[model samples]
Target: MAAATPGLIGAARAQSARKTFVFVSGAFCGGWIWRPVSDRLEQGGHKVYAPSLTGLADRSHLLTKDINLDTHIADVVNLIKWESLENVCLVAWSYAGFVGSGALESVGDRVSSVVWLDAFVPTDGQRVADLAFEGFRKAIQMAADKGEAGVHGLAKIPPIVVAERDRAFAESKVTPHPVGTYLQPIKVSGALQKVAKKTYIRLPEFPQPHFDKALADCKGDKSWTTFELPDIGHMAMLDAPDRVSELILQAA
Candidate 1:
């Protein structure tokens, strides 16, 4: 029984070591949106934390014009420091990519990998506003025209851009994100250039030829890898949780 005890202990240790803690940041979304994916990951013997940014989720009342991209970045950075989470797999979806990139700049060494899900990869001196679609710009402008103040004032999620079902879910769970976060320009330099690994999870339906070309250019450099989900839409996690979970696990 002594030898058998050692073998069982070793198996348990192996299982624990396989556990990867994931931090997911949603675009214009609260942590609640990650409930489904979090459930799947937890069931698979992993840990996941999805943080709701200020002015988002039940925290909508916290919305203010002063909340900018730096504020959101600081939120994630503080969470990592407070939790002392090392070797974390950070996943940024859509607009959260901007926030995630800032977080990466702050905690590059602590992150095991950075994954962008159908999101933007801003270059140096670029703002989230620079990446917005013309329609999105118009919508936000229209909202501002109505005399609504602050970032949360532009609370509109077009169904045509996101999957219909996911749009419904998002609409039900949606909260205002800070407009300042979108308006503030992100400043990147040599530090962010040194991140350990970067991966882009591309959604096939989004017609982003320039993004595809940029990602392709990075492929041969060994610092990046692009994974395409042909069957899924922009909201791959919601559209196909199983596959998204599987891919995340594999990446982990």
Candidate 2:
């Protein structure tokens, strides 16, 4: 009988500990928003993907009135399928909660855990309009009336606190988010809740009744784990990447 060498044992341990993380960005933002946290996770020997949804950021050229919630869901579902990812840790931010939830309908079996980070958590047949504030609803309507594919300027007033140095860079990267994605009702089948690990993280420095309510609701659910990072704002990934990465790892 032979014992495993330290290097071989470490390699085996790393392989066992490795995880796949798919970060879904919020409205008016793109995969770039997940860079800080993704980098940290990748450094820890995990496979991390932060894809820009259709009609946003790098994909802004594809923006059109035709892109809807299903389009975004396919974007994620296909990513999982084509990437051949299994036992994934799905992380959704802001408006992506709905998108992620919808995606779970198709890829839930592939997902081991789901985390909603300062994001919406909708039930079946609920659209973003159903959960969004009046101001947000108005913004979507205004964009529709203007015959625009997306709603602009919403990112100008982020609920999250951006440091001065990162402010300009972050502002420059934001693109108009497709309005169709918001108007369409997400079709979920409790797929998200079915995942083995469910978590809700609230970044509460700013006042957002919707996220506050989400945190409270999840707290009442025995199946879901909840956390509050009150020191940071809504974009906790950027404001506190270390903490965000740590939480995702814990959930995984």
Best by lDDT: 2
Report the lDDT tens digits of candidate 2 across residue range 165-234. 5677788898988889888887777888899999999888767788888899999999999998876867
Best by TM-score: 2
Q: Find the 10 residues in a row with the least total lDDT in model 1.
A: 147-156
Return the TM-score for each candidate structure.
0.86, 0.95
The number of clashing residue pairs in model 1 is 1
lDDT of each residue in 158-239, candidate 1, tens digit only = 5324567677666677665666777778876644447676777877676665456546666666787778877566667777
Q: Show the colliding residue pairs in model 2.
A: none
Native-to-model Cα distance after best TM-score fit, residue 168 in candidate 1, in Å: 2.8
